[model samples]
Target: MPRASLWFIRTGLLALAAGFTLGALLLLNKGLPIYPGLWRLLPAHIELLLVGWTLNLALGVAYWILPRFIRGAPRGPGWPVWAAYGLLNVGVILACVEPWVASGPWLASVGRALEALAAGFFAVHAWPRVKPHGV
Candidate 1:
């Protein structure tokens, strides 16, 4: 597997952990009323688990398993992958913390924008790899 794939998988795992932790805290808050504003984190939890964990892991696996170019290369140039990685991680971080920060709305907007751009880059990088089998 490529180093980029490994990084994506590992970071996805981290996102899973964070999502679970946040979920647990939310559940505890429901029963114990410990955290007054816990509901505000619901969006972050969903984003972490779905986008950060699931989507990221899927992308990583796709990057690893997808067919290569005619030259037997695993994928295209590395810069876009790296950019995706950076944008995804940074976006998720910013988005996750947005709920608690004073500049939350701004952060969330920027984060979402970054994530969208990252997805575009990922699609662009991976699209060429999709091909009919036994070509």
Candidate 2:
């Protein structure tokens, strides 16, 4: 497999780990009374899995696959790819503080939206017909 394919799998595994960790934490919180409210952990766990894991995996696949576009020059990683990665991580990080801060949900939502926009950027780079086989 290619190096980027490995990145995709690693990202997916990280996402799964985050999800499992969330479930375990929830159970622990309930049984051990680790915190006041278990619901407070929801956003952080969700974003870790969804944005950090899922989004990162998707972007990794895109890095390997999207270069078929741009016709003449191959699409290389630099500004656009880095921006996507940064936006996704930023969303996840913001989610961690979202529960305690009260105003965190709104901020997390904006981060999520920005991450989605970054995905759109990848799609644009992967524009149809750029591939020789037209996949």
Candidate 3:
């Protein structure tokens, strides 16, 4: 509906596509004997799909859905919306790409931190939703 909502929905859909595509790749890795380190690739694939796809999608949808949970408009959606979107997407991308390209422990760690920060934003932003829903 809104730009923020669109961001969330797009991110959710991207995450889904990532999961399915990456899952298939992972399966292909295991299936193809020519693919070296296929076994090792499996773990990264799983993490990418799980966190990158599933968790991110869930977060985005939550972000999109959160407006309804709060009173009024929610301070215009909070500053963390951008941070969450940027950090989560960047982190997941780095987490997925860096491991394959070059030394990425730092990138991965930063990515992890970013993702955590995104989660923190979600927690803070969605705090109002935590209360008894039926009340």
List the lowest-lDDT window of 10 residues for candidate 1.
Answer: 67-76
Q: Model 3, range 1-135, lDDT digits (tens) per residue? A: 546647766775776676677678767777775567555555456666778667766766766655354456643465677777777778777676655766777777887888888888767777766555433
Error of 2 at 68 (Å): 3.4
Q: Report the C-alpha displacement of residue 43, candidate 3, in angstroms.
A: 4.5
Ten residues in a row with the worst lDDT in model 3? 67-76
Q: Candidate 1's error at 7, in angstroms?
A: 0.3
Name the best candidate (by TM-score).
1
lDDT of each: 0.87, 0.66, 0.68
For model 1, how does the per-residue alpha-carbon lDDT over 4-117 read when each residue is reduced to its tens digit? 999999999999999999899989999989868889888889889988999789888988888877665557787788888899888888888887889998999999999988
Give the lDDT of residue 14 in candidate 1: 91
CA lDDT for candidate 1: 0.87
Candidate 2 vs candidate 3, TM-score winner: 3
The per-residue C-alpha lDDT of model 1 at residue 29 equals 93
Give the C-alpha miss distance for residue 93 in model 3, angstroms: 1.0
Better model by TM-score, 1 or 2? 1
Best by lDDT: 1
Candidate 1 deviant stretches above 4 angstroms: 133-135
